[model samples]
Target: MNIRQYLDSTYLKRAIQAGITEKENIKIVQGFVREAIDEQFKLVMVRPEMVAMAKKMITDAKSQVDIGTVIDFPEGRSTVEIKLDEAFKAIQDGADDLDFVCNYEAFRNGQVDLVKEEILKCTLLGLKHHKVVKWIIEVAALNNQQIIQLSALIKNVVMTNFKEENYATVFVKSSTGFYKTENNLPNGATVPAIIMMLENASPLPIKAAGGVRTYEEAVEMIQLGVKRIGTSGAKAIADGAVSNSDY
Candidate 1:
């Protein structure tokens, strides 16, 4: 299998998040972009602020790797208008895929209409711009039933409003790889969570993210019908090495 094709090489840490200076952080992002270009991965998933830089790097190298950026990031608590604004800017900055962290908190709080509206509106914006849209449900934040429900919610919104041909353009992604949990529970994609997503969000593809650190785990996700795997350890996975990064 061409593992590189399924990996979205990722680096989404901020300067403070990584405990580095701004200049040093950019240098790290530069190396990340260079590695993705050289490895010919499916995409480089970075923070929204890094989209323009990553776009330029790929353009200069003539690499086919696409640029993706997160919207509403680790916290899905932002209002829909705020999420849309963030996504619009990312799109204009040359992001090929927009992964929005769905407001799972609201859903958990029984604000179903709010969550549904954001999913529909944000997804429409992405489709209008011809970019792949993914809704990260943040599995670690919810129970199994919540995971299934949220995945189905995203699938329902897309299928109800978008054309069949565009179904593939929307994905139900697992996590942000940044959610903190009590007792150090797995805060990323786990097999059980992925199975629930796949079972509930059919036709619309799934992208397994968070906690997927090795090639075998990645392969398992693909075998279970995920369309993509987002990871900071794309190179390690491709090289058949186990990634020790907490992300």
Candidate 2:
């Protein structure tokens, strides 16, 4: 399969997250962007501050690689206004996609309305700007029932608020790749969790993030109906090997 088109070549680590100097981190993210351009990958998913850089790089290279950024990344605790502001700035900086972390903790705490409000507002921002919006559900942090319910909740919100022709602009993504788990389990999208997302959030698109680091694994995700695979391993996947990228 043409896996490159399905990969959002990702590098979301900050200087502290990867234990590198800020300069070094910028260089690494730049390298990732150039690689995405070279490989004709679908998108470059980076930290919000780097959206402009990705835009400039793709523009200078005369490439069509889309730029994407995360909102309330790794953790979904930001207020709705804060998330919207972040999304707006990224959009202004030429980002074509935005993935906002849904308040899974709020949902688990029975604050269902809070979760809905957060999703609704952030989604409206993306829709208004005509950017692709994906809700990161952080499946690793929830039980099976919660995953199913939350998936349904996101789908319901998208269907209720968006036009039928614009459903492609909305996505129910699997994880943030940073949520801590008991027993230190993988925090990204797993096969079972992805299957659950596909079954429960149908009609909405799926983007499987985290732990997808090889061509074979990415193929598996696409076969399971994921429209996008977010990974730091796009080059490795293009090379047909296991990626050592931690993000």
Candidate 3:
């Protein structure tokens, strides 16, 4: 089997959720990223505050690492203006990609148009700076109807802003690691319902995040049409799990 192809086939957004609390941890995470770069991995997503630090760490690295920052984060409670400002700040801090969480509460309250408008605003904000935008439509929080509506809204956004080349991704995520309890969402992006959304999305990329911890899970997500895999366990996946390796 072609291991390099598997590692290089999809976009892997290495998450730095735990390293944001201190400068030392940030340095350690940067060292980890250097190793990923040595392996030819190309993307890294960090918290809003760590963009500058991450940029400094990889500025002279050999790999083409694109920095990403999250807006409205896991809760999705911010106003459109606040989210836009966050995106702008991340860009100024040297982020190459913006991952904005959708307003789940607003969508659940039946505010479909309002949700689309907020996403449109974010898309515009990212495009103005020539940055890639990935809309994290948290599928775990949405019902079937909301998913269908969101899918259409994303398609519309991409079609209307042809020059911008705005990209949208459906993320099947668990609780943002804040809670201590176990999560129900499966590892990787291969959940049946998520696959259904990908099949319906057509053309747009699917980014599988939240619980991906092993190579088997990663491979499963790729087979299910996921174009990107978001994880903090990239090294473990690349090394291969003892029980799950097919090689």
Cα RMSD, each candidate? 0.7, 1.0, 4.9
* Model 2 whole-model lDDT (C-alpha atoms): 0.91
TM-score of each: 0.99, 0.97, 0.79
Give the number of the best model, judged by TM-score: 1
Q: Tell me the spans in candidate 1 whose CA falls farther than 4 Å from its real position.
A: none
Candidate 1 lDDT tens digits, 30-76: 99899999999999999999999999989998889999999998898
Question: Model 1's lDDT to the true fold?
Answer: 0.93
Report the poorest 10 consecutive residues by lDDT, candidate 1. Answer: 238-247
Stronger candidate by TM-score (1 vs 3) = 1
lDDT tens readout by residue for model 3, 1-247: 2232233212222245433446566665566557656665546667787778777777866457667667777677789999988888999999887778878678788787788788778877777788877776666566667766676667576666654234443232322322222375432233765666676565666666656667777788777777666665565576785322111
Native-to-model Cα distance after best TM-score fit, residue 136 in candidate 1, in Å:
0.4
Better of 2 and 3 by TM-score: 2
Q: Predicted candidate 3: what Cα RMSD to the true structure?
A: 4.9
After superposition, the stretches of candidate 3 with alpha carbons farther than 4 Å from their true spots are 1-21, 163-190, 242-247
lDDT of each: 0.93, 0.91, 0.62
